[model samples]
Target: MDFYLLLWLCPLYIVGTIVYRLFLHPLSGFPGPKLAAVTHLYEFYFNLVQDGMFIWEVERMHAQYGPVVRITPHELHIKDAHFYDEIYAPASRKREKYSGFVAHFGTPSSMVTTIQHEHHRLRRAPLNSFFSKRSVVQLEPVIRENIGKLADRLAAEIQKDEGVIRLDAAFTALTMDVITHYSYGKSYRYLDEPDFKLAWKDAVLAASANGAMLRHFPAMLAVSKSMPHWLLKKLDPQAAVLLEIQHMVRSQSVESLQRLQAKKEDNEKTNTAKTTNNDANDNNDDEQAKSIFDALNNPSMLPPEERTLDRLQDEGQILLAAGSETTAKTLAVISLHLLRSPAVLARLREELISVMPTPISTASWVELEALPYLTAIINEGLRLSYGVTTRLPRVAPTEDLQYKEWIIPRGTPVSETSYFVQMDPTIFPNPDSFDPDRWIQAAARGERLDRFIVSFTKGSRQCLGINLAYAELYLTVAHIFRRFELELFETDVDDVRLVRDRFFGAPRDGSKGVRAIVRGETLL
Candidate 1:
């Protein structure tokens, strides 16, 4: 009788485990490695503790599971381009971002995080103006002006050191300045400031680090908040930084609006004077080009209902966040690659020399778009050092999503792992090698490069900053390479490590950070 009871208990335990995983687990039905379904503790261990190398583990699983693999019970990690279509397809009813990560301040839902379709639509409408082709073209001068400042600063630093200077910090500063200028319309200047604002920088870094953990473990956020205020502060330095950045951003945004209002009033007064005196016309015309505020405030430009403070601020924050790190990181990685490959560097320098002798004072969007080598180098860099990886997860708003032989249940988090897809050996031969020739060849054959290119993502939810990012990249790379020769010192290609945050990736241990040795001062 005792032996019979023991036998029944053993089967019960085994069945209980299976039942718990299948029904009780957060991500049960979605196919994945058995371990992943069992628990997310491994995922957390790797991401937070091991510095985000878990994606490689997921890739290995995909090798066994074909295109789709469940990394988590609720999450499906897909790599096929067709899955991209199914997820981002226009007709496919999907909500905004998932509620895994909450906003830092206020209940305001920005374009990137808003979960509701209608709310996202409302938020994205006015914001679209700032990112439109015409708008970006108009804002080109702002980007160029910032780039010029950075070049001048770098040139000065090089001159001081006989044309050799570390560029990691410099690039960060430059991008920060550029984003600030664009976001606040030249009101705040971190560029010329002698000392870096620790609070601001810390806030951004902290927020970024915590953002990933919060997204993965939403329940822990409340527990994290419940800790003693000082203890919490001590435990999560990044949380403070995140809050500080949001505060600074909000404060700066309010100040920017105020300045715009004041400028509009001044402009009105100037126009009134011109109308009354007729002699003031010359003075009014001589006033600097219209600010971002002027364009937005122009009554004829957008409908009256569209102009709202909340909308403008929402768009401004998105633009600032989207544009800043992406361009800077791309430049940093491209510079690193060029420094490593003398042949590539020389070829690029030759191309720049042939294109513009005096460092291209001005190039139209169309002209820049046509530069083959420039496009190749940028595309290659983007491919290698993709700023953002991790699947852009979207939930199926409908009852079911049918793809191939599987019916992905509604509300299941479905996403394409861009990093894995972009690194496919079949699509990009020798995927690890930084070769621009692949892109050039593909472009020559008229193959639609956008199909597999996940740098800017695709469909309606694609990066709105795509054009701006490209423009900034082209101008910065073209101008910098044209003027200076970037040289890597005591560094190899393998030395650069990926510093992965929740949403994006940066260089770890400042690996890409290197000395830029002027051509005349160095022997190749």
Candidate 2:
């Protein structure tokens, strides 16, 4: 009797919850599939079981319903390109990140994953000056050094019969080296690897691949992070790589803290003896701060609680992942399109030659950015890559969000994805084609096509690494095109096409990624 009563109660409770969500929930008035309103399992089927196909399902939802549709039972998605700014609002408008959405990456303490808008600003304030455009321009040598190394790697491939290299892995290695060097005052030197440390890139992608499934079970992220290496390897080889990364970052953070403490103690002991010594010590400390880790650990920059080892490790992981993967992916896309279109490639090479002259000649980022054709090519690449493919949900904490007739209640989670905006058929005609002239023509008519490029997003929570990413794109694109002649090797449009929406965009499963043969050096 007791068992039968318990079983009947469970079914009744589930039915009650479903009926309440479909009719009694605040978001019930909004448009979307009734099944979606019933339970999150509707989303689970598409994203988790179907492997990141929910993005297309959301598009279908918009076509049947209007632009504003309840995506999850608790969240709303807006498909209007024009409404992007309002959702991802400016600094004045207080917007917080939704906790459930943010759990995808599982980096709670990192500025990128910080839930509150105010706290994010507090954390971001000290690092702002370091990532500024002028600061990145100052750091150009670090970028060029890595680019030169990459060029050498490709040049070596020229000697082999196969000569075919995977651009995605190669570019990932380049960006990884640069970001690691910047962050730790030393690089992982992935570019130095024979196969470009392909496993590390796979590890990063594996983390992203788990994002859709992890959203519903965020605790698994913590479980994976804490699991013993032997057990983790049994679960997933990539998870072991992920664990290795976590351990590396944690060790680095500990070393940084120890160095900071030692410096402080040494300065204290020396302070009583000489004024000149104090000034010299200050200069030395400033030099030490060149490493982003040093800056983050500095007491002047962040509070004690914020600079804890665990938090710092989280920050390091986020930096490495964000700085490397997105830029590398964009570079791969740009390279693919350039190799595919000989005419565009020739035009770009011609423009680059006017500045680069010899194959080995060098040009500054500022100079490369000034070229109209090169800039158009870059803008087109950014459009096609579409930055983070996942929907970034932002919440209006203080006031209601107005979208046409509907009033989004305060504290509701709302989001817009760049993939949809950048590829909107109404805004960009022939959205699928790799045409750079669209940007050129749009610019000739005084149109602001750049406004549509929201790859880095906008407003207060925009990616802090934007300057770093742009600098990498400009230098890498300019260097490769001007120095080497590459041809598509068993690669086509499908190689770069985004079929899955992980945190980053993913091409179809089993795709070899963009590959090319390094035909001898470019000769003007």
Candidate 3:
């Protein structure tokens, strides 16, 4: 009996030791806490519960481990800017995105979802026209008009309260309006009419909250994915929220398509009239120019068999989701920082004033783009806030890629957390402090700023709406400051806190939300 028991115990001990050596023992040479290599669930729990400490944790690991640190058995976290090139370079092997963070909503993969290089190329081809420089320039008027409406609305509020206004709701409204316009055209005015349906608002809020839960608990998502859809919905409220969001997007997309068809019909009629009069040559110039919608609708522009209406509509929703929430949150954070730093705010206002005079009806994009201080402030806000703090995990395309001394095997999920990159003390002295001047000085010196900038991810998979984002931020912030001085009313600047979300950070604790008292109502 004793000999038999010993035989069983010997194999069990060997298995345990092998597991340790494969994970924790070898990773000990690199420097992360033992628990991190042994199991990633602990770190995941810390990230979920520790109120924005995962960034600091990753920074500590990078400081100790040089550049590459194993965060889990199958994962490596990288910090070196040089590695960014290797990781994102087109020539280098590509990696699949971590399954936990992927936006899998039952629809086929879009550009943002495609993991394979070939698939990504195919996915991005059709959508490229919508984000091209020319496309952005053409859409500038739409963005400017929306910004003007936002300013006018805020000014009306300021007039009501003696030049004081709460900017939280106003900014949210403005971004939603701008993104929706670009996504579905001007037919759907969610922002113009003041009354946003409470049910729709609740659905959006619920979807955001549930999304956070799903990211934190990947196992739950996996389990739900395996379960029957009807049963899953009954068991999990998050599933229901996800379904509701998809439904909302689909319904809105259908309406947008109908509107697009109507517009096409009107254009055809106008063209026919011009041709009848033999004025076709002159009227060709008068033809309504192609909008982003027109570009998406063009079959010749997209690859064969990929230009289906459903695919285009799905892409449109993706743009709306990606553009709207992130832009609004970034704007809110900037407003909070500006209100807190009165001197910074004053300097930015001065710059805006120099660029545009009082009684400004319309300022050209060229004029807005020329404002150095304005661009610096926006860039700085994005850096400090680093609103999307989560790791953008990409999978290794092939086995045996060398990261430092360690060979990161294929099928491993590798990522660098932007939160850590943004907070590097060497890169930005006193990284926590909100200093727009850092960007200004960097620009003046002509130092390579791209190393420090990853507000949008780098390389081929970079944010498609980057130009649009810049245009929107420039116009919106410039116009707002040109007319009104923002002052923090209820919330203390230091009291500002981030409400952690799955994909991004938002304001926490019903922080009466960036209430800015507007000063100097009339521009003139």
lDDT of each model, Cα atoms only?
0.65, 0.88, 0.65
The estimated TM-scores of all candidates read 0.80, 0.95, 0.80
C-alpha root-mean-square deviation, each candidate: 6.5, 2.1, 5.6
Total colliding residue pairs, candidate 1: 4
Q: Which ten residues in a row have the lowest lDDT in candidate 1?
A: 100-109
Clashing residue pairs in all predictions, respectively, total 4, 0, 3
lDDT of 2 by residue, 353-468 (tens): 88898989999999999999999989999999999999999999999989999999999999999999999888899999988999899999999989889999988899999999
Better-scoring candidate (lDDT), 2 or 3: 2
Report how far residue 182 has shifted in candidate 2, in Å. Answer: 0.9
In candidate 1, residue 184 scores what lDDT?
Answer: 56
- Candidate 1, residue 31: CA error in Å? 2.6
The Cα error of candidate 2 at residue 1, in Å, is: 9.2
Task: Report how far residue 365 has shifted in candidate 1, in Å.
Answer: 3.4
What tens digits encode model 1's per-residue C-alpha lDDT throughout 343-363? 987788677665665654456
TM-score of 1: 0.80
Superposition error at 323 for model 2 (Å): 0.4
